[model samples]
Target: MPVQTRVVYQVNPSMVNALKTIREQAYNASRGVINQRVRIQTVDGQIYEGVVVNVDRRHVYLTVPAMQGYGRQWDEDLILTLVLYELLVITLLYI
Candidate 1:
């Protein structure tokens, strides 16, 4: 029986810079839509519609409408923290 050894490789500096640039672009795009109603679709096919509340390097926060049912009043809004890289599309909703 032969034992297998794990090999780890170091990331290239250029690749790291490229990834940083991409992340910054994504952050800026998300920031542009802050306080505006929009629909976001994730890579996993989950759709979320809400106003962009906040954004960071790795996540976009949205304040979505809460589901109402059971004769209960939903006062608080639902906030969703979605991963930035996982977002596929963002559409602005015209009022």
Candidate 2:
């Protein structure tokens, strides 16, 4: 058997800058809808409806209503942390 060699490639600077710009846009858009009810769809087709609580460089935090009757003593809302790049759609909810 012959020896195998591994090659490593560096990412292009232009592509990095483009991705950074896209991320910044996404963050700004998400920040605009903070504290508002919205529905978010991921690239994998999973959907989540919640209020936009906060956003960071790489993730958006949402506060979703938790289901009742699980024999818990305290009541609290569920917080979902989704990746920014994985989000496909974000729609404002009226109700």
Looking at candidate 2, the ten consecutive residues that score lowest on lDDT are 66-75
| Top TM-score model | 2
Worst 10 residues of 1 by lDDT: 17-26
lDDT of 2: 0.88
Instruction: Please list the C-alpha lDDT of all candidates, in the order they appear.
Output: 0.88, 0.88
lDDT, candidate 1, residue 17? Answer: 80
Best by lDDT: 1
Candidate 2 stretches with Cα past 4 Å from truth are 1-15, 68-75
Per-residue CA lDDT of model 2 for 52-89, tens digit only, reads 99999998999988765548643689899988877878
Candidate 2 residue pairs that clash: none
Per-residue error for 65 in candidate 2, Å, reads: 0.3
Candidate 1 root-mean-square deviation in Å: 5.5
Give the alpha carbon lDDT tens digit for every residue of 1-95 in model 1: 99998869877877888767766777888999999999999889999999999999899999988777668767889899998877878999999
| C-alpha lDDT of candidate 1 relative to the true structure | 0.88
Looking at model 2, residue 82 earns an lDDT score of 88
